[model samples]
Target: MTRLAYSALSSYSRVQIMRLVQDHPGRTITDLCDETGLHANTVREHVQRLIEGGYLVAETERRTTRGRPRVLYSAATGEAAASSPIARRKAEEAARRGDLMRRVLPWTADAELPSDALHQIDALVEDLGDAGFDPIIDEGALTVDLSPCPHASADGSHRDVLCAVHQGLMEGVLTQAGGPLRIAQITTSCDPSTCVVMLRR
Candidate 1:
């Protein structure tokens, strides 16, 4: 049995079509067009791509009362299943992290504060630092540059910890000084040592 090459799959539409076929195997082009709200031509195009990419298999099924045989489409079940394990694992991990965030955010968002927002920023950096992250606060932005590159060093589990900590810090600050707080942007680079965060009020 040949395995599906996930890297060969690109484009949101193609991915969506594959997922639909996987869920409802042995469906027709008309069925997919109705389900996805895409035109028949568009569905055909994606299906052809999937078939060529080896992610799907096509067959003909004959009905007893039908005038002619109908062509049916279905995911290459064994190949699709094999290729999907990593993606499924990642999704499960993400869900778990989301649950953890839900629990942590409320506490962070409700904390009382004394004075000096800059001091609060310092405290957040200190906390992150103590937790093995090297945090730097400068010019209205706090950047936590992790030494070990969490993605490379730790399993996917650390994502929750990192997310919760950042959420806690943001909530703690915004709750105290309640007015427009902007989380400019958060990014991770291919190099684990380089993560940048931009923030503004």
Candidate 2:
């Protein structure tokens, strides 16, 4: 993760917004304000920060008639190349980090694991590390075990939100990494000691 993205997600409010948008795309600022109980200006600021960090994408809402179209925000799923210069730079940095991490990390010498899978794993591991997941990868099972989740202290609804945001983050990273690998499921336990993320082609 780039510094900007790290900073953007550091705010709990922003993570909530990300989780909301990821769950329901094309949400307007007013919608976010109502759901989050944040002032419209505050919601707009958070949304803009998410956009600048490349965690969210913004679009002009389509309208048949009437006043100006509302601006909608949704999680960035890496469907398209980075649109802004800041986002582009962050992406380049992430790619560089992924390459460097792959080089320093141990790998299965046997050709059992394809290069594409390795690339995807590298990206996922890098992002998880940045987010303080301390991931342990099992190449054989194609699963990642995340221990001591940073937000493990959160309970109930907050826990659900954290899990959703984390899952979305992984999905975005995997998509951007550009490989056949994808997240099949993420099993999060009430006991924050460990959360297993299963991946598949």
Poorest lDDT segment (10 consecutive residues) of candidate 1: 82-91
Clashing pairs in 2: none
Model 2 whole-model lDDT (C-alpha atoms): 0.76
lDDT of 1 at 186: 62
Off by over 4 Å in 2: 80-92, 100-110
* Model 1: per-residue Cα lDDT over 1-201, one tens digit each: 332333324444565666666667778989988888999998898887666544567778868895887778866533333232322332233334434553687443223322234333433343344334555545324443444543345445644344443443343333332234445666776655566556555
TM-scores for all candidates: the values are 0.37, 0.83
Task: Give the winner by lDDT.
Answer: 2
C-alpha RMSD (angstroms) for model 1? 16.4
* lDDT per residue (tens digit) for residues 22-46 in model 2: 8898889989999999999999899
Q: Name the TM-score of candidate 1.
A: 0.37
